[model samples]
Target: MIGAGAAGLATAIFTGRSSPHLKVLLLDGARRPGAKILISGGGRCNVTNSSVSERDFWGGRSTIVRHVLSGLPVAETVAFFGEVGVPLHEEPGGKLFPDSNRARDVLEALLREVERVHAHLLTAHRVVGISGARGGFTVDTLQGSIAARAVVLAAGGQSLPRTGSDGAGVQLAQRLGHTIVETTPALAPLRIGRADGSFHERLSGVAHDADLTVWADRQVLIRLRGSLLWTHFGVSGPLALNASRHWARAALEGRAPRMTVSFCPGLRFDDADARLVAAARERPRAAAPTVLAAWLPASVAAALASEIGLPDVALAQVPRDDRRRLSHALVEWPLAVEDTRGYNYAEATAGGVTLGEIDPSTMESRVCPGLFLVGEVLDVDGRIGGYNFQWAWASARAAARGLATTL
Candidate 1:
């Protein structure tokens, strides 16, 4: 085993337990294991998703996720943890967390299980090279070379480098003759360097609920509605981050994507326009700030007004063009994309080992026998909310089950 992150840990755990007699050596570059798990979900460690289904995954064979997850279902995952003494609680968004409400609890549970199963976890052992063929594999590391019957790359994605997913495993896969999809940041904050630049700089602490969408060349690309936070550089939170994956990928292909956010998504455009018109009519003497205050945050509304060239215009005496601008602002506020913040800011990376290279049932590389890829290392990225963890669990299980023939 190489890279003792979530997928690596889970893979080792399952493989070790499935065959207690087999000696499994788990190698990780980090000093402590499960660093990502420790900080995931703001320390709550969203272990899995109740909404886990094939449909949640992005950019891969949808059926593959179904097949793998079917073999190691979420219920079984919950049960596995339950047996290991970690009681889980489900949040409103189908997100599962430990009853202790601490990320360390989830990490500790997995660590305890690994220990119980007698899996030898070698931490701080950075693997420099993986050699040998098929059932004979030797991993050269910082400490020393350790030979294994099989090699599983669960090194995770480049996102969260502090967690030890530093794109090293991708290089290993590439050297092993696997086709790697162009990797870029996904589930990251969308940055607007100009136009909304000042607002971006000052709106760091502001958060609002809205529907955000991204478009490329007048074509709608991604749409998500959820809580979004305005930051010093750009937008974060659910809607922005979810839409960001598509935007990041699209931008990488040389097509600059445009972000369109509906501040009032629940309201129809016509209804919103009429409401604005009515607000002006009812309060002919109403201040512009007062009229729009009800619809948006004071700073956000003021910024919108300025962006649409209506900053000085009175609400009651608002000109036709200004009203139209306000309507447009409310409907689809445009933010140009320069580039994504990259994996450092990403919750996940969108591209990896192409799904076609591996058998969905086994997660084994068709390109190389005894070589398995799991978690974000593969082209299987999911939307936010425990979907990535589900991928880790499912893909890890698939790899372990496939290795059962040898173990």
Candidate 2:
């Protein structure tokens, strides 16, 4: 067993219950296991997404996820935790967490299960090398080398390197003849304005619930709904991160993707135009910014007014052209991407080992026997909420089962 994160921990729990005589050993590089779990969901730790479907997951082998996840159902995973004494509460959008609303509770629950099953947990220990063939394998760690019949790589992704996942596992997998997808920051923040950009320093810290869209080379990409955060550096939050994968894809192909925010989600252009005309009639004497401020943040309203060349004129005196322009800007606020925040701030890695290289049914490397890859280390990543946790649970369960059976 490798790693002690959601995937690794869940694997231990299941494996411990499945075959107590297997002598499962979970090795983690972190001194404190579940560091990511501690800070997940702003410290609450979203456990799993309730609205899980095959469409929710995207990657080279998305179809593979459906089959893999079906084998280890979400209901069973939730029930497994429940049977272990951890009550769960679900938030809007099907995100689940411990009833206590503390990530530490989730960690403690898993830790208690590991202890109960007598699973050996060695923290602050790093595996430096692995060598062997056939049914026997040797895992060389900082402390010492241990012999095992199988090994599972659940060290997670390069994102949140502070949590102890720094891509060491990638190099190790490569040595074993597996191809690793060029890893990049997946669901990370997008850098919008610089000190010189028009929107620079204008709306930092201002948040608004809006529909975000990303496009590259005239192709519509990701679209999602969430609150966006304007920072001194750029734009962030769930919507921004969700669109980042598309941005990264565009950049990799030498094309920069631009983003647009729709404050009026699901509204047709004609409807938005009509709304603007009505606002102008009701507050004709008001400044264009003031008119817009009724529906948007004051800073955003002012910025949009400027972008549309409204000149801060009173709505009553504004020309029809200017009014039309303001309507366009309000409906579609365009933001150019200066760049992404890189892996340092990403919540998860987007790309990794291709799904074809691993057995989706068992999460074992089809390239190598007794070897498994799971978690963000693979190309599998979910939208914000608890989908990522679902991946962790499903992949870990499948891998652990394979390891137990093989050993």
For model 1, residues 1-407, the per-residue Cα lDDT tens digits are 88888899998899898877778888999999788889889989888987688888887788776887788788988898789888888998898988899989888888888888998898999988987767898889988888888899988889978788888988898888989898888888877778655766676778888888878777888777898898877888887888888887777786768887888877767888899889888888876767888877888887777766785756878877778778878988776656677777888988888888998878888988888888889887888889898889888899988888654
lDDT, candidate 2, residue 67?
Answer: 72
Candidate 1: lDDT of 249?
A: 79
Residue 100 Cα positional deviation in candidate 2, in Å, after optimal superposition: 0.9
Model 2 C-alpha lDDT per residue in residues 1-407, reported as the tens digit of each score: 77898888888877888878888899998899899889999899988877787777666677887877887777887897787787887888789988889888888888999889888899998888877753788988899998887888888888989889888877777788888777778789887754337573677788888888778787777777888888777888777888787788777777667788887776656787788788878887888778778888888888877766786678878888777776676667787777889888888887787788988877888887888888877878788888888889888888777877677
Candidate topping lDDT? 1
lDDT of 1 at 381: 81
Highest TM-score, which number? Answer: 1
- lDDT per model vs. reference: 0.83, 0.81
Clashes of each: 0, 1
